[model samples]
Target: MWRQSHKPTKLFHRAQRCRPRALALLALFLVASTLLLCGIKGKPSSQYDPPKLKRSRTRTSTQFRPTVEYTNGTDLIWQIPESPKAVLFIAHGCNGRAANFWDRSPGCPYCVGFPEERLIVLHALDRRFAVLSISSSRKCWSLGKEKHVVKWITTWWIERNKLEKLPIMALGASSGGYFVSALAAEMRYKSIVLMIAEGVFDTMGIPEGYPPTLFVHMPKDQRRMRLIERNMEALRRKGVRVKEVRCLEFPLSPNFLSDRILGLNQTMAVKLIRMFSEKGFLDENGYMRKDGRATRWKQALRERGFPLEKYELLNHIQEELNLAYGYHEMTSLQTDDIFDWFESYMN
Candidate 1:
C-alpha cells in the first residue's frame, strides 16, 4: 500500500542519471572504434600507388604522315617527334609548297631526283626535332605579310607543343631564303641556313644583334656569294657571327672536249639557258647566239640601286649565272653538311 504512493528514492534517481551518461559514453566509444578501424583499412599498400607517370616511345620516322594545319590561309605541315629537342622552320622556294620541301615529290618542276628534302626531314625526326614547313599563300612569298604569319604560326605551334624554351632554327631555299633573312632580322632565331638566297642581303639590311647565319652555296655561285659576303662583312662590322660553306665544287675536268663542248656542268648549262631565255638574251627558239649584244648588267644594277663598277657588274653577272645553274645540285649534295652545321648550334 505504501509503495503504491511512494516518491522515487535518491539512489534510484542517481542510478537513472548514471544510466543515461553511461549510454552516451558507450555510443561515443563505438563511434571512435569504428573510425579507428576505417583509418587502418584505408591505409595505402606499398605495392600500389596513385599519380602514375606515362612513358612515351621515341618516334624515328615520319613515313608519309604529317599533321596539317591551315592558319591565316597558309598551310603549316608539321612533322613532330616525341620529346623534341629543337625546332626547324622550313620555307620553300618560289612556287614551292610545304610538301615539296618536306618530301621529294615530282610536283616541283625545277628540280628532279634530289632526295635531300626527304632526307632532311627524316634526319630531323630522328634527331627528335619538331619540323615545320610553311607554304606561301601565293606563287611567291610576300615577306611583309608572310613574316607576321610565320611568327604567329610558330608561336602557336610552340605553345601547343609546350616547347617554349627550345632553340629555333630556319632553313630556306631561293626566295624562301629571302623571307627567312627578313624574319631573322626581325625575330630572335638561333640560326639560319640559306641555300641560293639571291639579293636577300641587298633587300634586307643586316640588323644589329642579328643571329648567326650559315650561307650554303656552290663554289660557282659568285653573284649570290658576293652579295652574301657583303652582308657577312656588314654583319661582321656590326659584330654578328656568320659562316659560309661553298658546296658542290665543279672543277673543269682535264678532258678538253668535256670541259669546253659540254658548256659548263650539266646543272649550270640548264640554268644558264633558262636565265638567258628569261632575260631576253636568247632567241624565241631558246637559242643563245654568240653575236647577241650582252645586256648591260652593271647599268641594271645601278638602276636597282646597287652601285657597282663596270668590272664588278660583269663579275656579278657571271656569278649570277653560276648560281642559277648550280643551286639545285649544290643543295642536294650539301644536305648532310647542312644538318651537321645545324647540329653544332643546337647545343
Candidate 2:
C-alpha cells in the first residue's frame, strides 16, 4: 500500500511540472498562427519596424522646415512658422555660422551641427516665433558695416511675409550679443537675450528706452561675471527691465551620453562611463575633474577603435560635454527662461 501511494504522488508531481511547458507551446502556436494570418492579409510582420533612436525632439513638420538664402555676400538661414506670433533674429558668436542654430531639414542639406543651439531655435519655433539668422560678414560681427544690411534684411523679410504687426525679438551670443545690443538700440526689439555676453555700455551705450534684456551667462570666469553684473545694474538704472540666468556645472551619470546623443545604447553608455572614471576624468561622485573640452576622451575612444566616422555624433558629443561642464559656450539649457523673457515683454 505504501509503495502504490508513493508512485501515484511522484506521477502527480511530474504532471504538474509538464503543465507550464504545455502552456508555453500553446502560446507559441497562437503567436505563429496570428503572424501567419497577418501575412495572408497582406500585412508585413514586425521585421520591417525601424529601431527607435535617442535624439533631440526637434519637429520635422513643414513649418519647421529650414531655408538658406545667400544675399549680399552673407548667408541667411531661416525658418518661418505658419501664422507666427513673433519674428526672432538670432546672431551667432565669433567664428560661428548661421547654421549653428539648425539641424538637418528636408529643404536644407548643409544644416547639420550644434545640437545645443539648435534646441534653442526649436524652442523658439515651438512658441510660434519665426527664426532668422545672418552669417557675419567677417569672422566676427562688424557692427558698423552689418547694421544697415541687417536692418534692410529685417525690413524686407517683415514686409514680404506681412509680419509687420508681429513683435520682433533678438538673441545673440558672445560677439553677436554686442552686435545685437547695438542693433536693438537702433531698431527696437520687444525683448532681447544675451548669452555669454555683456552689454556694450561705454561704446554703444544702452539707451533710455532699451528693450527688456535677459542675460544668460555661465559666469565661469570672474572678469566676465563682474562685467555682466555692471551691465545689469546699468540697464536697471536706465529703467530697463533686466534678468540674469547663471548656468552652473552639472554632475555626470551613466546615461549622460546616451540620454543626449542618438545611436548610443545603454551598454555603451555604461562602458564609456567606466572608461571615463578609470581615466581619472571623473571624481568619486561623477563630477568632471577637468574641463570636458580638455579631456581627450574622443582620442581615447579612437585609440580603442571606436567608430568616429559620423560627424553628427561627434558634434553632439562635444556639445553635450561642453554643456555638462557649464563653460563658455552656446547652450540650450536656459531656453525656457529665455523665451519667458521674450513673452513677458511681448505685446
Candidate 3:
C-alpha cells in the first residue's frame, strides 16, 4: 500500500512537539526565590532588611544621639543627655574650661551657681532632652588647623557608627567666641549661636554664602558691639540668622559686665536661665514680677547679685567674645531655645 511510509503514531507526533520550557523556567525561578527567603531567615534583620533611620521629627525636631566618636584624640567633657539629640560644643574663653561657665558662686556677689556641666543639660531639657558639654581644645579655632579638626570630628563620627545624622551646633560666650565663629565659618555645621562673643576672626577667611549663622553679641557693652552691628546686618543680608540681644543692663551695666560673674548654685542658675530664655518668664515689658511685685531687670540683677554696675564680662564686649577654646571663668550662654531655633533654622 502506498501509505507514505507508515504515518507517525499520535504519541510520536506529540513527542516531536516543543517541550514546556516556559513552565519549567517559571518553576525554576520560583524555587530560587524560595531558597533565597529560606537562606535569609538565618541572617540578622539588618542583613535581610535595613534598620529604619531616625529623621528629625519636624523639619525641626530633637532626639537622642547615641554611639558617638571623638576624633583628633580631643578630650571632651561629654555628657549624655537625660534625653538626647541636641549637642552643644562649648569653646571656653581665656583661662576657662567648660566648668567655669556657671552663674552663682559664693563670696562673689551677683552669682547664683557654680559653673557645672549638669546645668547645661538642665537648660537643654526644655528644648528636648539635649546634651550640652564642651570639648577640651587649647585655644583652637576653625580658621585653620581648627577647621580641619572640625571636619575630621564630623566625618570621623559619621563613618564610625550608626547614630542619627544630627548636626552639631557651635556656641561660645566671651573668650570662647573665636572657636564658635571659626566653626560657623569653616565647617558644614547645623548652625551657631554666639553669646556676648565676637572679635577679629583669627583663622576664618570663609567667603560669603557660607552656612547659616546667628551672632548674639552684647548690644550695649561688648567692645565693638555697635561697630559689628553693620557686619551683623550684612550677615543677615547674606541670609545668616542673627539676633543682637540688647542687655537692658548693658552700657547701664559696666563693660566687664558680669550679669553673674560666677554662679550661685544650680538651683539659682536654673531660675535665671528660665527668666532670661523663656518669653513669659519676663513680663511683656521685659520685667519679671517678684512675689507679685514689679521689678526692673537691672534691679532684679542687683537682687540676684548680677549687679550691672560692676560685673565685668568683657573688656571690649567684642574682643573677648572670641571662641578659640581658651580658659573661661564662666559662660553666659543662651538656653535651650537656641537649639529650638536651630530646628526652624535648618528646616
| Candidate 1, position 92, lDDT | 78
Q: What is the alpha-carbon lDDT of model 3 when measured against the actual structure?
A: 0.41
Residue 311 miss distance in model 1 (angstroms):
46
lDDT: the better of candidates 1 and 2: 2
Better of 1 and 3 by lDDT: 1
**Comparing candidate 2 with candidate 3, which one achieves the higher TM-score?**
2
Name the candidate that leads on lDDT. 2
- Residues 1-347 of candidate 2: C-alpha lDDT, one tens digit per residue: 00112343543465456657634543443343222211110133343221112223333333447888998778898888777999999999998888877766667777764766777887788888999988999999987869889988988878987889999999999899988888999886999988888868768776778898888887575688789889888888999988777665555543546655545554455556667778887776556676778989888877756666643466666677676666777876567668878998889
RMSD of 2: 17.3
What's the distance in Å from true for residue 340, model 2?
A: 1.0
Regions of model 1 farther than 4 Å from truth: 1-64, 103-114, 249-325, 328-330
Q: Which stretches of candidate 3 lie over 4 Å from their true place?
A: 1-73, 99-113, 116-118, 129-142, 154-161, 199-209, 250-337
Global lDDT scores for all candidate models: 0.56, 0.72, 0.41
Residue range 247-266, candidate 1, lDDT tens digits: 43221111211122212332
Clash list (residue pairs), candidate 2: none
